[model samples]
Target: MIEVPSRVSVRDLAKVFQDGEARVEAFAQITLEARPGEFLCLVGPSGCGKTTLLRCLAGIETPSAGAIEHRLEPGAPGAEQAMVFQQHGLFPWLTVEANLHFVLRESPVPRQEHDAIVQRLLERVGLARFRRFYPYQLSGGMNQRVALVRAFCVQPQVLLMDEPFVFLDYQNRIVLQDLLLELWQEQRQTILFVTHNINEAIALGDRVLVMPGTAGPFAREISCPFGRPRDVVQLRTNPDYQRIVVEVTQLLRQEQEHSLREGRIG
Candidate 1:
């Protein structure tokens, strides 16, 4: 597969929503840069505007203020970006294989190669046998995996993920995380992932950015010391991993406390 390189630059970003007669600030004065093929994770408590910022970056939502610039290499595919939601967002009527085909149908992949692409991705994730199964027939974890590869099959230049594993049980979440990492390592799409899980952030991110719940820029930034081709399961045993976790935990706690004191969170 050919690589489509892209860079994302967000400057002084701010978002506000209307609630009856009042305006609520989801995030503000946020500035950041995502280099090509970089895995950047946004971790923060609820209402931190993590998802809001992601939507803005995806061009799904219009920011009240600020600018986002996307530089796509010439000849990049039209569908240069894709998003994975917290919910599976699978079609209840479509079978697993059919669901994948739905995405490929709109992608730049040629018609003759669609079947091959679908088969290869399904086999890589061990879902080849479940091709005929409907979404309801699969477990929550399997559905999430389907959502993931569906995005990957599109061969997007930028992938935006909003806590795709948040609803799964511990074991399933870890399993999907490993699968995600495997695909990401191979494809290396510029990704903006949102998660409240600190461990998951440290496990997957090349750099972790912490947001302060209200309209504010990232409160902290931590670069991962662990090397890539990471073993998410074994990361817990590494002393450096533990130390970074502690540091991030403290940063989050401070933000949580500030939000509480300001009555932003109950």
Candidate 2:
């Protein structure tokens, strides 16, 4: 079996904004990598630049300093990376098939294969019969499923997701999480996911990074060694899973306190 190339690398990454005379550091000295075909979850407090870091990885924002490198495997099928946003960015007017086709049209795949690829993904997600339905016609979870499939439809080498299911209730969130895992298990694309929920992070990530706050980059990297095809509901009750979640949550709390103290001193 051939090894997949490392999909992304960030070195001494920093993003700063100028607010009048004051400098705002979103995040700095953030060094990390998205291992080939692995899921990496990022967790942090609000204003800690999780989304900013993700946007930088997506090439949607220029870093004020440092570098982000993306290496594609030889003969890779599509773009180097694709991002799924928190808002479930499906076009309101486009049908499900049309939404997926919109992405494929931008990929390197042959135009004639677009329809077949779109149909296959929709079928896999159990949305085959809703191909002609618009975004407004579907429930929030269904729309999110479409957004996810659309991202995968591009067959990207890396997937960057920023809390794509954060707004959904527990049932919907877990369902989409399972759907995401299923798609990922089949394709094994490199993924960098950002979330506030520690349980969600542990449930889906191979490694979870905890960001301290705006004052620091990533403060800790916790490894989750659970076996494949994880059942979130069952994992919730598993002692090992609970232990990891508590460890991660404690780190987050400590970071928040540290940040508050530093703020007062500054």
Looking at candidate 1, the ten consecutive residues that score lowest on lDDT are: 71-80
Scored by Cα lDDT, where does model 2 land?
0.87
Where is the poorest 10-residue window by lDDT in model 2? Answer: 257-266
Query: What residue pairs are clashing in model 1?
Result: 28-215
Candidate 2, 205-224: lDDT as tens digits: 99999987545568999999
Report the C-alpha lDDT of model 1 over 30-113, residue by residue, as the tens digit. 999888889999998777788889999999999999999988656865358889999999999999999989988888767888
**How well does candidate 1 match the true structure in TM-score terms?**
0.95
User: Model 2: residues >4 Å from true position, as ranges?
Assistant: 1-5, 262-266
